[model samples]
Target: MDIVPLLDRIGEPQAAALFGLITGLIFGIAAQRSSFCLRASVVEFAHGRLGSRMAVWLLAFSTAVVWTQMAELSGMMRAEDARMMAVPGSISGAVVGGLLFGAGMVMARGCSGRLLVLAATGNMRSVVSGLVFAVVAQMALQGWLAPVRNWIAGLWITPGGTNFNLLTSLHLPQQSGFVIGLAFALAALWLARKNRVSLRVLFTASGVGFAVAAGWVLTYSLSQVAFDPVQVESATFTGPSANTLMFFLTSSPVLEFDIGLVPGVFLGAFLSAAWGRELKLQGFEGAGSMSRALIGAAFMGMGGMLAGGCAIGAGVTGGSIFVGTAWLALFCMWIGGMATSWLLDQRGAVAQPGLHVPH
Candidate 1:
């Protein structure tokens, strides 16, 4: 938490990168160990079942919400300064983009963060899809698609351009997030009990949330002490994947949080998979599956850029802090995911994961 000394030793950018590495490491290990995936959870929901997958996800989501709220309440972090709050956002983008991202994740059979983690574990299908995702994300961010993203996002700006906190917008109590998080935690516990989820899995899932909190505290702490300004942010994959890609392609690369975060996650996942004996080379089932994954990746790349976040980004990170756009996006994601899952089921493919991995 005390980052001034670290800043003095390595300066601001390096310090921030260090924090991102640490955060990503924790998230990767936890996510891999716990088998956490929003796609899996959505699959369960689509079938009208609350299984271990649902339990793990709810625990992670609630944990992030609780810890993030507590940090802000205790004055350990200024959540308000985070770009999710301070910057103008897009309502139109959230609705449209969330739907696309939700459907894309179903087809891809994983979210952006999930793809990266699986790729680190030697999932070849994920590797190809992830690469496609990063490239498309780069295009969306600054290449041929920028104008489209900007135009769509410009459709509906945040009320007054920035005064749209979810809690404030809804006139809810100040501590509503904490209260709701506690409720969700209790529900998660009950579901875990019913689903027979083990304590080890739950603990690992909690680490996923802890990483979100650590990301916030670390970056905010650095901003207060660093000589140059640093943006306060937490974990997300779409933008960072695109940014890391650019870092590698550029003549001159800079070390920053996004750069550190991606490789840290890869290292963490590789180590975790090796330790767990879960490392295996898996590829797409056929051309059809490969096409599905690639198409899904493209949709996610575009949607994540337009929405300003992916599942982990908006659904967990921004949702924890009660961002209005984030919650709306998260809600729409569930709807999109469920609807896509149902359509796939009707088609008899269920957009079945290109290759099989243990649940």
Candidate 2:
């Protein structure tokens, strides 16, 4: 959709926020209904099964990859200009941050995006954890933790500096993205069918992916037509969560994409849950669970900032575009998640004993 006329009317910031709201709403509903979560997928993998949860994650991820590549091929978006690519990335940060974020996901029983979705569905445990996640994320971004994040991030740089691309590093053709995305889609389909994931689940999971792709394309499209420059980006909760928190705290807050995105996701998730009669007030099973979740949220807040994105942010959003550091981060996340699952899940209620995973 050409947004030039709309840009003239509502201005760039407002337009971006509007788009973010729409993108987030789609993502929230799809994720809420489909239970698209990387943490559960990793746990399933650790348990030696590609079950329904794993299938949902795979479907959402592959669908994002496929659609993103298609958009690039159609000239609707240019992934090369996205911050994940344009800005120099850190190898060390990806490794360390991914490990922390993954382990925290296990402890928290959800990743940042999943936590927000659960919170919207009236999970009090998630609400507390989510708020903590936001505060820590803000700290990591600009507070005392910023120096630490910066130091770690400076430890290792991407091989080719700012213009790095995984596919390019591998000497692959431009069309290879489409080919690779198609392959991912096929594998995801195989997993879905094997796991007997319902059609409804499959469809909603695909919606999540589509929203991610739309975020990239729509934002890029806006940047092309707008009088002022805008960042081309896609869905990610870490920074957005922090920004949203500050938006409410400050008297004269700036209008931006992240500001609208968080509330939009919450509203969308809440609406879907309420409509489906799935909204229920839930709290921590015990003090152990609450403390564990809060600690996990703290880890995720710092780790996500250091790593450059959260699970959905780096794994699905950036990975779809074949960003070098993003893929590395995603790979490390899986390794960390699998390791944590093996250690915690194998203990049979060892990780937060009475803590119940929200459905």
Candidate 3:
């Protein structure tokens, strides 16, 4: 009984697709249950309520950082293999793109990953945003926006002219970087809990964070078993989102479903939602709201393309590794988000303007 042959028969692409579907479902269900939203987290923080979502994001970052570094140290992966750490990296592009992405997320009310989860949970606005995000991301990746992004990327200056993580660039070792980064994360968690931390908030945040970290560990590590030549990497959402959309379109050419992290997130979310009886279909109320979602999606696509990652990619995964570009992107994303939120507030776009009619 050669089970290895049977497993191999299933193939990689199919595994990836199945992974994506499962990932989407898990992401949808968890997000729906905990109200896990990146935009909402930032908004709440901005408004002085930061005990729940922010903690979860921080915990996820901390867990990913520790796990990724351990993977590197254990010969399972290499930091240099990540796209954000590549030579000739686009520093300017990351900042500019992050700003745009941040702004767009605010306008659209969620990041691309968040939008997918929301869509699965019957948020029609999110579905519109996800569709728009996919279309514009594809366009930006291979259409009119490509040249512009390239031009901006060309302006980056690596003064030291070396390929190194931020810690190394500052004359620190990998171990020191790990320790310092972990310390910072712990400090943030401490501060978040310093003033009236609730156990519910802590549990939800920690659980979600662990789930996200587990997601990366499982998919990347498992995939590497089949593709032994490649290094395993984890905890990215943007490029995968765009790639999944393309895969959906070009399914005829590639017919294998490989279980990847994003797909796992979807599956996990979906199952979680189904178990809780929360799955439903919903649509946008009107053209105006739909238009806003579309615009937000386009911005997210363009910005994520330029920046080379999204909230999860740059903000948590790479950022935790102390990747300089990731930090730049994260800062710009925060700024862009804050700016967009302010603009939206100015326009009084807080509440749904009309009645909620079922679709």
lDDT of 1 by residue, 215-311 (tens): 8888888888777778889999989999899988999988888888888888888999999999999999999899999999998999888788999
- Provide the global lDDT of candidate 2 against the true structure: 0.89
The better-scoring model by lDDT among 1 and 3 is 1
Off by over 4 Å in 2: 346-359
> Which should have the higher TM-score, number 2 or number 3?
2
Q: Work out the TM-score per prediction.
A: 0.96, 0.95, 0.80
Q: Write the residue-wise lDDT of candidate 3 on 233-348 in tens digits.
A: 34456667666677677845443222355556666666666777888887776787677778888899989888877887777766755678777888898888877776666566
Candidate 3's C-alpha runs over 4 A off are 1-33, 157-163, 191-204, 207-232, 255-262, 285-287, 349-359
- Compared with the true structure, what per-residue lDDT tens digits does model 2 show for residues 1-359? 67778888888999889989999999999999998899999988887887888878888998899999999989999988897788899999899999999988888999999999999999999999999999999999999899999999999987656837888889999899878877877888888899888899999999999999999998899888877778889999999999999998999988877877788889889999998999999999998889989998998998899889999999999998998888888988888888877776556556567964322
lDDT of 3: 0.65
What lDDT is obtained when candidate 1 is compared to the true structure? 0.88
Clashing pairs in 1: none
